[model samples]
Target: MEFLQPTSWTDALAAKAASPEAVPICGGTDLMVELNFDARRPAALLDLTKVADLAQWDIDDGSVRLGAGVSYARIITELSARLPGLAMAARTVGSPQIRNRGTVGGNLGTASPAGDAHPPLLAAAATVEAASVRGTRLIGIDEFFTGVKRNALAADELIAAVRIPLPVGPEQFSKIGTRNAMVIAVAAFAVALQPARKLVRTGIGSAAPTPRRAPAAEQFLAGALAEHDLWESRAELPGPLLDRFGDLVTAAAAPIDDVRGTAAYRLHALGVMARRTLAWAWRQYQSASPEGS
Candidate 1:
C-alpha cells in the first residue's frame, strides 16, 4: 500500500527497521508475479532500486562481488568473459525486458527450487551478503535455501550482494525445457573443473527440492579420471565414465510429477544436461591447457 525508496544503505536499513514486515523490493521480477495474482501483499514496501551503493560491483582477491541490484543484462554483458556459467544462466532467465529489470537479489529472495541462478551459484560456491541495522553477514549458498520457496533471511534484512570465488578451471551450464527460451527449466546443471586440485563440482536444479551438488557423481568422476591418469594425462574422458556419471546425476535428483514436467522426463533430462555440460566443460579445459610440457 505504501512505497519507500531509499537512496542509501542507512536510509534503507532505517526504513526496514521502522517497518519490520515491509517487503524489500529490488527488481520485483518474482514479487510482481505474486502481486499480480494477489498471492502477496505487504503493508509497506522498501524499494532498494534507488540505493546507489547497492548497485556497485567489484572483484577482489579472485572473488567477484555483485551488488544485489545488479541486473542480468549487466551480468551477461560485463561478466560473461570471466563467469561464463553465470552469464549462461543469466541469459536463459527470461526475456530481454525481464533480464533488464530482474535483479539477482530477487532471484535469491524468491528461492525457487528451479531458479536459473541457483545451480550456477552453487557450483561456484558463492556466498550471499545480507545487511540490517545491526550489521552484515555472509551466508554460504548451501545454507541459504531452506526449502521450496523458503530462505533464511530475516524480516529486517536486505540482501546486499552476492560473492563468488573464481574457479581454477573451466565451467559450463545448461538447462532443459519444453521450449528453447523463455520457459522454466525442467532440469538444469552447472559443472566446474578445479584442475589444480583435480576436483570437479556439479550442481543440479529443478530435479530436487533445492539446488544441490551431485556429490556421488563428482566423486565417481574424480575416481574415474584418476584411474585413467586423466588428472595429469591428456587423455579424453572415457565413455563409461560419462555414462555412469550421467546415471549417477540422474539418480541424485528428487523430482516430482508436476504440471511443468513429469518426474520421469525430469530424470531423463537431468542426465542429458549433465552429460552435455560436462563434455562442454571438459573440451574447454582441454583447449585452455598449454600446448605441451
Candidate 2:
C-alpha cells in the first residue's frame, strides 16, 4: 500500500480524484483497529493528518466549528467549559491513548450508531461540511447518519469540519454501561434546556439504529414545564408522563441482545438517564440564571 500525505486541501482533493478508491485517513483510531485485524487493506491511503487547513477550529456568532482532526483531549480540556455536554461526551470516549489519537471526524466517518459524539452533536443541531474534487456540501447531523455503521458521505469526499449551533441554555450528557470508563455504552443520553423558547431537546444513542431524538418526551416536557418558571418543576417529571416517555423512547430504540448489553437493560437505562439528565440540566439552568430574575 502507498501513503500520500498532502499539506493542502487542493492537493488532497487531487490525490483523491486520481485514486478514487484510496482510503482517506486522519486519526487512525478506528481504521488502525481494522487494519490490525486484517479486516481492511486499502491499495492506497490519502493521509489528511498533515493537512493544515483541516485542523483549524473556531467559534463565531454562537456557532462552533471543529476541524476534522480535532482530538478528544482538546475538546475535553478546551471546549468543556464552553460546551459542557459535548465535553462530557468526549471525556467518556476512550482511554488517554485513544483520546489522544481519536478524531471527531473519524467517529462521523465510521458512522457507528453508538458513537459517543453522535448524541451530543444531534442535540446541538450540528452540521457537517464535506469537500470533494467536485465541490463542497453541508449536511445536517440528522441527515448524516443513514443507518448502523452507514453514512451519506460520497466515495470521493472528505469531511472538512463540523459546525454546531451554540446552546441557549444548560445542557448535560449521561451514559450507562457495564464498566465506568473505556467501555462501550449500553445507553447514552444528552439533554439540552432551551428556556428562552420553552423547549427541551433530548438525544439517545446505543438503543437505536441511529442516534435519535425523544420527540414525544420532549413534547411532554415542553407542555409540563411551560407554566412553571423554576427548576423545581423537574421533580414532577417522574410521574405518569415520565413512564410514558420512557416507553416511547424504548419503542424508538432498535436494540439487539449484543455482547455488551441486553436490549432490556438498554431500554430501562435509557429512560433513567433521560429523567436524571433532564433534572440535572434544569438545576444547572437555574443556578446559571440571575437571582430574583
Candidate 3:
C-alpha cells in the first residue's frame, strides 16, 4: 500500500480530495490492527502525524476544540479539569502505552460500539468537525454514528477536531470489563448534569449498535429534578427516581450475545452503571456551592 505524509492541513486536505480511498492515520491504534489482520487493505495510507493542525487543541468561546490527533495522555493531563468525564474515560483506554498513542478522533473514526471514548463524548454532547477541500461542517455526536463500525463522514472528509461544551456541573463515567485495563468494555455508561440548562444527559456504550445518548432517561430525570426543585435545592436523588432512570437507560440498548458477553449481562451492567454514575454525579453537584457550580 502507498503511504502519503502531508505536513500541512491544506496539503492533507488536498491529498484526501485527490485520493478519496486513502485512509487517514493518526495514532494508528485501530488502523494498524485492521491492517495487520488483513481486515482492510486500503489504496493508500494518509499519515496525519506531521499535520500540526490535527495535533493541537484550544478552547474557543464556550467549547474545547480538541484536535483529532491529540493523544489520550494529553487529555488526561491537560484537559482533565475541563473535560473530566472524557478524562475519566480516557484513563480506561488500553494501557499506558496505548493511552499515549490512542486518540478520541481514532475512536470516533473506528466507530466501535465498545469504544470507551464514545460514551463520554455522547454524554458531553460533543460535535465532530469534518473538513475537506470543499469546506468544513460540524456533525453532531448523536448523528455521527451510522451503524456498527460505521460513521457519517464523507469519503473526502477528515475529522478535524471534536468540540465539547464546557461542563456546567458534575460528570461521571463507568464501565464493566473482564479486566480493569486493556480489555474492551462489556458495557459502559456516562452521565453529565447540566444544571444551568436543567439538563441531565446520559450515554451508553457496548450495549447498542452505536454509542448512544439515553434521551428518555435524560428527560425523565430532568423532569423529575425540575418537579422537585432538585436542581436548585441540591436535594439527594430519590432512589425510585434513580431506579427508573436506570431502567430507562437499560431499555435504550439493543445488545446481542457476543464472545465478550451476553446481551442480558450487558443490559444488567448498563443499569447498574447508570444508577451509580448518576448518583456519583449528583453528589458532586451537591458538594459544590452555587458559586463553585
Candidate 4:
C-alpha cells in the first residue's frame, strides 16, 4: 500500500480526484479500527493531517465554519460558545485520547448512524462543503447521509469544511449507552431552538438507519412556541406539550434490536431523551433571562 501526505487542500483534492479509492485518513480513529479488524485494506492512504487548512476554523457572517480535520477536543474547548450543541455532543464522544484525535471529518466520513456528531449537526442544519479536481459543492445535513455508514460524498470529493448557522437560542444533546464514556450510543437525540427563526429542530440518532430530523415534532413545537410567543413573558412550557413532543420524537425513530440494545428499549429511550433534552434546552433559555437568573 502507498501513503500520500497532502500539505494543502489543493494537494489533497488532487490526490483524491486521482485516486478516489484511496482511504482518506485525518485522525485514523474509525479507519484504523476497520483496518485492525481486517474489515478494510485500501491500496493507498491519503493522509490529510498535514493539511493545515483542514484543521483551522472561523466564525463569520452569522455562521460557523469548521474545518474538516478539526478535532473533537477543539470543538469542545474552542467552539463550545459558538456551537454548544455540537460541543455537548463532542463531550459525549470517546475518551480524552480519542477526543483529541477523532475529528468531525472522520465522524461524518464513517457516516455511522450512531455517531454522536450527526444528531447535533443535523439539528443545527449544517452544510458540508466538498471539493475535488472537478469542483466544489455544498451538501446539506439532511441530504448528506444516504444510509447507514453511507453518505452523499463522491469518491473523488474531500470534505473541505462544515458550515452551520450560529445558534440563536438554546440547544442540548443527549444519548443513552450501555456505559457512560467511550461507549456507542444506544439512542441519541439533539434539540435546538432558533429564536430568530422561531424554529425548533430535533435530530434522532442510533434509533434509525441514519440520523434524521423529527420534522413533524419540530413543526409542532415551533407552532406551539409561536402560539405562546416563545414563552417570552415568563410563561413555562406546558407539561402536555412536553409529553406530546416526546411522543412525536419517538415516532420519528425506526430502530431494530441489536446486541447493544433492543428496539423497544430504544423507542422508550428516544422518548425520554427527547423530553429531557428539550427540558434542558428550555431551562438554558429560561436561565438566560434576567428574571429567571
Q: What is the C-alpha RMSD of each candidate to the true structure, in Å?
A: 1.6, 2.2, 0.7, 1.7
Q: Candidates' TM-scores?
A: 0.96, 0.93, 0.99, 0.97
Query: Which one wins on lDDT?
Result: 3
- lDDT per residue for candidate 4 within 1-56, as digits (tens), equals 89999898889999998899998998999999999999999999999999999999
**Model 2: per-residue Cα lDDT over 42-133, one tens digit each:** 99988998998777789977888988888998888888867778889999998988888888899999988788998888888889998899
Q: Candidate 3 lDDT, tens digit per residue, 93-151?
A: 99999999998889999999999999999999999999999999999999999999999
Task: Check candidate 1 and list the clashing pairs.
Answer: none
lDDT on C-alpha atoms for all candidate structures: 0.87, 0.82, 0.94, 0.91
- What is residue 188's positional error in candidate 1, in angstroms? 0.7
Q: Candidate 4: which stretches are off by over 4 Å?
A: 290-293
Considering lDDT, which of the candidate structures 3 and 4 is the better prediction for this target? 3
In candidate 1 the C-alpha lDDT for residue 114 amounts to 91
Give the C-alpha miss distance for residue 30 in model 1, angstroms: 0.9
Clashes of each: 0, 0, 0, 0
Descending-lDDT candidate ranking: 3, 4, 1, 2
